[model samples]
Target: MISRRLGSIAIGLALLGGTGANALLAPSAEADATTSRTYESLKNGSFEADAGWSSFAQGAGTEAAVSDLRASHGQRSLRIVDSSSSSAVGWASNAIRVDPGKQYTATALSYVASGHAPLLYLKFYDSAGRELDSTATSASTQRGEWRAFPAVSAWAPDGATHAQVVIYSLSNRTGTFFVDAVDLAPGANASLTANQYFHVQNDGSATPWGWYELDDARQAGSVVPDPTDAANGVLAIRPHVSTGDEWSGAVGTRFSASEAARYSLSMKALRQRGTPVMHAALRYYDRHGEVIGTDRSGIDVVPGRWQESSLTSLAPSGTVEAELIIGCTGTVRCDTLVDDVTVTPHWDTTFYAAPSALGSADGSTPESAADYRDDAFWQEVDAALETGTARVVLTDGQYDVATDDDALHLRGIGSDDHRLLVSGESRFGVVLTQRADLTTYVVQVRDVVNLTVENIHLTADGTYVTPSAFLITEDPTAGERTEGIIVRGISLTDMPGVKYSGVGVAGTVPSGPGVVDVVVDDGLFARGGSGAGYHHVYATRGATTVRVSESVLQDSAGTYVKLRDNVGDWVIEDNIFVSSGTWINNVQFIQWALYNTTEPGNEFFSPGPYRIAGNVFEAQEGWCAPQCRVMTLTARGYNPVDHDGVEWDHLLDPVKREILMDESEGNIETRRAVVRQNFNLALDDAHGISVTDNEYRNIDTLMTLWNTSDYGAPSQGGNGVYDLSNLFATYRDGL
Candidate 1:
């Protein structure tokens, strides 16, 4: 049976029956004292099965089975009609049977009615039957409609039994295809809170009763569950948004609440027109998902009118649980439509809290530790985060935060494994010799809302100056600051061990309609973060949607993540940017700017389109500074006054000297980028970027000035060059 179910979960995963059948399919012991368990085994997942499933087609197609047509939930579907335009495997399925090594996950709810399936397998077989490992997902996981495909794994290797799903259909557009519901489980940990406890459901989380959907086919074009349609039952989902696509749409439900001050939600949106918008937001997370705040429901969604929209967000000051979201955007097709939803609580407990910060009663522990982190532990954590869902637990020591009050308040209370730590008197760490720079900030996260700071390790000899050491943006006297901040697995070392500057995480831009979403993952930003010449992780003016992933921005000295006069939405991926030391260009540790600072739309350089993927750069050829030009976008008159009379804020930076005190009023060059795949690199002085498929081992300069100079040198201009596909493995001097 698929090699006795891959002999039990792929004995070490290599195409199938993994890890000796997942250690002989371990789970027993009454399913580990049960807290959650679901082997699933397809009950027709959500298509509500009729024929359980048994389709086949092999080489050219004509048709297959199970079809009630349109469905991502409830109704029924599994159609496949490859009228053979040529190549084909069309469709195949004979599913069920997996446990060996136990780690399973296979899901499908795809939707693309006519033509499409440039490959969509999911195989597994063994036991005199060979083919033990397989997983494919093509057409870049499009979203013309129904979505939810991204999860495919197969470790049932050794003598692995059987499980299948084909559907290749090479061309002829691939012909008509549509699969629905289809899940094989066993692998719970979906963040257990007693498992699927979603509420406010009128059918919102359709699919099979549980809930999950996080679209991003290059930015929302589909989310699913709308199988066809519904406003309150039977089914409903589809959070698309376009402008062609950009971080796409959203559909949420994560639950848990507290730390209130406006967090209502009501949903039922609509849109075919009316400018496109379907929002009813609420993000606020923690326990490492970060995002401490995001609120909407300022209601929008008009056209086709289903109305009922109602939002209220603004829940910082220690928010508890969150994730409501239903966002959608605009421009391209828009289609926005969300359904029946309601949420309310925090009827104003007069900002309730305090009683050992509300400990016990199930927020698990915290009856009193006294050293909660200090400043009265944030005043009983801002009064137990003002009611409902609150928790605090950290035990190890070294916390000396005497609270200079950067406003991470807290107390709104919670219990989903929240934590806080500062650690012993720089014990040999923060040396100013213990008076430790009296606290300008080794950590300061303003406003607050679902903050998550995991696995900390601090160090700051940032020699009293740049509030280095993990300090995120905006506190302009509170006014709606901070937004879901998260700095994971940190390690800031100093005295050259690796590095740590005063700007491990310091973003500015937050005054005038706020926006912030900092996610510095897998952290380790060595060489004095944000201190020496600044930028291990820095942001200015537009700090919206900043996501520095799989981190490791070494020897910082001249930009490593600097966004000035910012706008937002940047995703610098799988990093490892190491340059011995040199700045003023070339190894320009990620920098983006328009007029340097001053956000609120229009004036050009509007935030992003940046998506510098899979990195591992070593853009050598050092000796930065003077006449600098390895990487720089100094438009708006590239000479804000060359060193002459140098007070120009050392060459402008108060938002570019306020756009150079209104340099004849004009600026907005909208930055854009998408430098792909990596390994060794040098994408210098790159403007309006776009360079695909890379493999630049090390210098000779890959691309130096794509958008060439500014012509007049003021905002965007002439051939800043765009478009350049499949960058035939590089070793270059020009584009």
Candidate 2:
């Protein structure tokens, strides 16, 4: 007998007349169209028989079927197939119409009654009997247990356009089985929105739903919001401080905002005190949740009263959304109250440029404005110096000069804001030359003292080599002391071609002992010619009490900072030393030779003691030759060397040394030097130095007395040497 079925509508044909039948044709056009067409369940139900398993059943306004197929719980039902098979041979199957060359997801929910096979197979075939794609599942089934088996497959029927699923049962056959509740759906997957917030419920006794308290600068209240409700609920949030300690609101969503527009956000805040200033910051974020813009405002918070504050700023380029933060670091009394938060676009209207002055070089002076190389400016400056009231101001533009004489000889007159740029590229020689010939310049006290030079940037190209850059040589025949010269915020670079010092200042040769007090601050000294024997920045003889601070010196072969003989009372602080080389060396801080020989007293030495503080020393190995001595301090005098005169203090003591390194040891070699308190001396890479009051930890060699002027090894007196108190001899192999 031959049988055919179209879903739940089946047709059976029994070959009752002949044994040799060529073909049994049931020419029913309705059957052909119905069997070829696919059926999708619009409702949900169970299957009572094998034939019924292939039919679509509807229940409770939902489509369902029975073939051991099910959908994810709480999800909309689509299509399903169920199988009822207790043994391997008695497995049931189902057929469904599907589009050719399309993909579909089929799921099966089932459980074994009594047996456990290693695996189960699911096969697919076309209406003409060609195989498509096959899948399998592990075969450990329990009776009446339901499980969902999902398989995603693509159908490529050669010519036929429909496909069906076949279930292969295990070998053992036993109890009866039933299939129910299957589904199949279209489309890929779904995603959540940007502003969506999720919360998990914890069963409790208080309110049936989870709730917390809110305590901020502006207000104190309890939070009670339903987790199931997506809107109108308060969320617990924490704040972060980027610059100062203050609390502010955080952004809840990431929304794209245009860059060509401006955004302003307003919020209300309150404080506990009468009135206090609170910092409110609006931060912009991009699509990936990165901060891009920050707008800040100071809000006044009144006690128990809410005040509104608005912050405005241009929208950042490519900014989508941003968070707003409010905080206060002054006191806890300052609290931020936020309500009715609003964001909007900015609208404004006006623009203009300032008017230019007549006969003034408004940054439009040509490169050939003034002949810097000529002796004209300096000649006028020198003549004005005789009357003692000379001041030169060169505004914004470049100045060219070609002079064989002193560029600007300011005897007692001061020069400021004048970028005395010497640019002839070919006429390379000394830039500025100062002398102490008169008592004033421009009728304003020139040579007697008190001269100031500020806001000057000097540059020289290394294209040519000459005598020097700038020389401040005084005449000893004047029989007067030249003092008080403040040079602030000046930059000198690329003039390796000149000889002498890049910027030199020296006093009278032997004119009753000359004294020059100078201050050089915030300058950049770099790169000159090699073998020219040129130091980047130098101080010549008879210059005392010079302070050089907040400057950068780098990229030269010669010494970066140098002090000649008779120079004293120096403060070198807050400077960065880069490009490996000797930083400062040679010449004593306090030399007795210049005390009685040149001047009446030791005004030639640094005025009293000097200090070198807060400077960073960085060296690149093998590029520039490293200095053997990082810093050298000496007191070459016949007087008794005490803590009051020419004394060096090492700031790193035992505790400090231990904090800086795992271990250290050494005694610094300096005259009247005091090692600061709390430093560990007996650590690796801290040996062979001299410092006062250093702690030694498991150090094998306590002290090495070599070439000591006082005494030999075991009896060197007044030497700051402290041995390890708790000795561990077993680990003393390498010390």
Candidate 3:
């Protein structure tokens, strides 16, 4: 099962309000038909009304006022001046009624003329005047220029009855900042736009891009020159061992899916060497990252000739995604070549769309395919969902959602029960293009039960505006999260603005349930943002049980996958991480910061069952002058008082460290992981963790595992090891 072979350990992982004219406004011109784009902008959203907002200052020399010094989209802005050594200053809007469980995105423009970063918060309160919950965005980082401040997207908790938008900063130094165009809209930014748009275009080709070694180095798989035709390359699955597991020699790709549905699986394979028993199978997974069941090829292969195998089977119950495998098992040396692998919808209501097909199209077939550029296409999709699951099959062509304004190409699947599948002929066969900036996503999902976007290419020409290719998010209430989603078999290129995915899960609260049961498989995430915080796949604030496998991730400015704080139960396996690009903070290939940074005791503790097995980490020589690390499992925090008097030197003291672990339940940092059977090339070492049964080549130090808790410092002691081995890496000592 997936739990055994694929390394998946099952893990369990809005907004409000109302008002009249000031509380509810008409939909703007940019709002799409399906979106409840009607939003309640605070009476003083533009700071034009002097009486609707209350100003507060906590220090002697700090003050707030409506000033004409600068504005973004208005004649005036809220200015907070802190002339004292320490102060809290800003304006708070009157509380507005909100839906108890809906998400709201708090946005504003800020000019941090000097001093520290600004802060934006959406504070939720219950009907009894008691605070329920509050969420904040990243501190505003831009200075001088009037730029969009960080987002404070969050859900109104179960008891919340009102929400107040607070724009302020608690600074310890003298500074000034201006804020304008503030609004708290109900839903994510991408949820307010058209729900049927794509971001990049590709020259529809049947063959996908970026397939790499499947088994790390055991039974290698790569795109090698075709044995039949040297000029062309084919996927070569070479089984080095004569015999092993039933699914040993394999080449595979993964994609997101829905449960209890039949999928059409097919592939062309040729035996280039030994008479190995060719095998093809489909491994299905639940949103919890656990393997549910599998389906295999029904017919046997005819050796020494190209043969095609196809099968139809129902996906096991609870399956949200699946991997398509092509390979062989043998008692002797074997080599197999594969091509034209595909998995398409079999029982869902299917529609066809093509770029050039227009004129009263019905989307019944390719000849009558709906024109993707027309409103009718979206209407067609929106209508189909009123009944059951729907599949939109796109013909090979470029589908661009071009808009002149900064408005996002927000597309969401509307149903909470039925699934929606948007499939292309191949990963490079169909393309989705968006002309908007980084604030937008190629595909954004919120509150959907099951949705899959696969076999397509997403690109941004040179626009560094889109931060992710696919983003699954929701500011969910307690005990709820956006779940059962997949993004598979696609290519993301020239996406310099993407700080998250090829596929990312964002906007989750550390206190609330986060996005879970998500899978990102068989895609190419390359040449992305080189910014300090940018990464290929980023799961933040309680996201857990996510599986990222069988894909190529290359040239990230930062690391490939970043599970930042309170994320756990991630299965990252059988993928290739190629580091040959601009290096800003390329410190770790896959970093897991899985401990609670602010919470005391074990309230918000989330260590891990993080499985990092059967993968390859490769880097170019001199890419990171002193050499980069393969992976890191550390905390993004210092001593937070849970271990009151423990000093750096006392970390090694058994009694002291034991007290630290006991009081905190070892939640200060990443305390568990499985790092085995991996191939590290040109990687110098790992931090707070060691490896076993893994091959290393061209490494600087043979291998060094630090046993420290002070952010992987070599001089400190560790708390304990949480993996299967004797020494799991943590803060200060062994576990």
lDDT of 2 by residue, 1-735 (tens): 111122331111110011111111112221001122123321121221112122222222222233324322211122321222322232223334343323444444545444442232333454544445455554335545555454434332322233444333333323333333333322221001111121212233222111222123323222222343323222323223323444433332233343324556665555544227766565677534776777777776676765777766665544546554445543243334343344544333111101112233222233223333233444554444443333334434333223333244444322221111112221111122222121211011124344445444445422444444544445566545555555544445555454545556666544546556666664545554354245555666666766666555554435456665556556566554444233222211111222122111232222334444444333333332222222332222222212234322222334433332222323331210222221111221212121222111111222221111121113112223232311212123222
> Tens digits of per-residue lDDT for model 3 on 1-735?
000110121110011211111111111121101111111334446553232355545458887887778865324688888887756666666556565445677777888888876677777766665566666664566688878766777766555556777766665556788887676766632211111011111234222232334464522233343545422234566655645555554434456557745677666677766764676777888766888997876346567787987787667658766876655555666677665555666645888878667545888887888776555566667677776677888888766645522221224344555667778853345766665564556666665546677777666656556666677787555344566677776666566776656567764564556676778876666667757567788887657667787666767777678776546567776565656434453545776554423323121223244566544455544455554565654432233222232222312335434433442444322212212211011121242223322212222221222223444333234455222222322212211
Identify the candidate with maximal lDDT.
3
Best by TM-score: 3
TM-score of each: 0.30, 0.32, 0.46
Cα deviation at 48, candidate 2, in Å, is 90
Q: For candidate 1, lDDT tens digit of each residue in 342-364?
A: 55532221221122234432323
What TM-score does candidate 2 reach? Answer: 0.32
Q: lDDT (0-100) at residue 671 of candidate 3?
A: 18
Clashes of 2: 90
* Cα RMSD, each candidate: 26.8, 32.5, 23.9
* 10 residues in a row with least lDDT, candidate 2: 15-24
lDDT-superior candidate, 2 or 3: 3
Q: How close to the true structure is residue 214 of candidate 3, measured as C-alpha lDDT?
A: 48
Ranking by lDDT: 3, 1, 2
